[model samples]
Target: MNILELRKKAVQLRKRTWELIYNHKNGHTGSDLSCTDILVALYYNVLNQTPETVGTLEADTYIQSKGHAVEIWYEVLADKGYIDRDDLEKGYSTFNSPYIGHPTTDVKGMEFHTGSLGHGLGLGVGVALAAKMNSLKKHTYVLMGDGEQAEGSIWEAAMAASNYNLDNLTAIIDHNDLQITGTTDSVMRSNPISNKYEAFGWNVIEVDGNDLAALIHVLTSENNTGKPRLIVANTVKGKGITVAENRADWHHKVPSQEEFEEGIRELDAQMEALNHE
Candidate 1:
């Protein structure tokens, strides 16, 4: 898809996501909105895996380490036909529903169960390492939260990725800078993450994560450096809706009826504008 197409899909997903969260009365609202673009770009453009292609050892792998934002992921997967759209919209976050707040192996598109914050990169490293040993062409992409950087285990995984020279591994940090409690700056000082990754032998690249074109370029770039690549995606905590953008309180909070309406209007305007563009 072109940039405009990707942008429209993102807005559409955001509209559905707002409905899901507002109606269900659950979700990491800010976190889900913040990473929607990146997820959209991947599912629509970068990833070679599809509903039929996923699960094979040789297929491209995507792991949502920042799994609290699973609502957006579920929407993208549904849109891509990896999972049933109606099943997700109807059963999400309800009793006996498999569409929980985090990614689970029970889900059609999920490769690993995630939500424990700092374990995703390690799992990706393991997959990439195995792929390398088998001389497979698969690439493993892990999307992690900036707040998750505080976990010591993530660093250990970083070291392992480097040590193995896993060029097929790509780790993306959704650096929205806010957590459930407050700003990541105040909760834990994990800034200068790029330089830290560089020291760990990762080819660090920083970009406006909310920018679809930029994300596509960086995500699709070749890694000639023979090291794992890391993208520091600078993004707002709540990206699409003006009322929630950068608001720490919105991290895991449900929107009031008034706020939900306002957000839907904003996303609708965005979709219309993209059509004109």
Candidate 2:
């Protein structure tokens, strides 16, 4: 898809997220919104796996390190045909549901069950190393929250990825600036993200997290850079909703009926604009 089309799809996905969460009365609303564009770019442009071959070893892998945004991931999976939309809308985060609050490997396209904050990069590093050892051509992509970077384990994994020269690994930080408690700076400052990743010996790129064109360009260019890559995606906390943007309260807060309607309308307008462009 072209950049404009990708943006339209992202707006659609954001609309779906609001609908699903509002319908189910559950989800990490702000975090999910913050990561939607990056997710759209990956599933639509970068990642090589599909619902049909998600189980195959040759397919590329996507691991969500910041697992609270599982709602967005689940929605993307369903949109991509990895799972039925009915199952997603009905069973998400419920008892015996495959769509839990965090991603699980049992889900057709999920590479890991992550929600713990600091563990995803380590898992990604291991997957990248294993792929190198086995001579597999598959790439491993992991998404981490900016707040999650405070965890020491992420650095440990960062060091390992650089040491092993895992060029096939890409870690994108959803730099939404807000976590569950408050702004990331207030909770635990992790700024200078691009510089920090560079210090860790990885190639770092900074982009507007919501910009589909920039995301696709950076990701595609980084693929053959011969070094582990980190894209620090600067994003708003509640990306698609003007009223909720960068508000910490919306991190997991469900919108009221009125707010939900407004959110969907806002996304629809954005989609319409993209379509016209």
Please give, for residues 43-119, the per-residue lDDT of candidate 1 as tens digits.
Answer: 99998798888989878999999889999999988998988989998999899889999999999999999999899
The reply for model 1, stretches above 4 Å from the true place, is none
How would you encode candidate 2's per-residue C-alpha lDDT over 1-277 as one tens digit per residue?
A: 8887788888888898888889888899999999999999999998999888775778888889999998988889899998898999988868898877788888888877788889999998988898899899999999999989999999999999999999999999999888889988889888877888899899888899988888998888746667899999999989989877989999899999999989988988888787777
Clashes in each model (backbone N, CA, C under 3 Å)?
A: 0, 0
Best by lDDT: 1
Q: What is the lDDT of residue 148 in candidate 1?
A: 95
Residue 130 miss distance in model 1 (angstroms): 0.6
Per-candidate Cα RMSD to the true structure, in Å, reads 0.7, 1.2
TM-score winner: 1
Q: Could you tell me which residue pairs clash in candidate 1?
A: none
List the pairs of residues colliding in candidate 2: none
Positional deviation of residue 258's Cα in model 1 after best superposition, in angstroms = 0.5
- Cα lDDT of all candidates, in order? 0.93, 0.89
Error of 2 at 6 (Å): 0.8
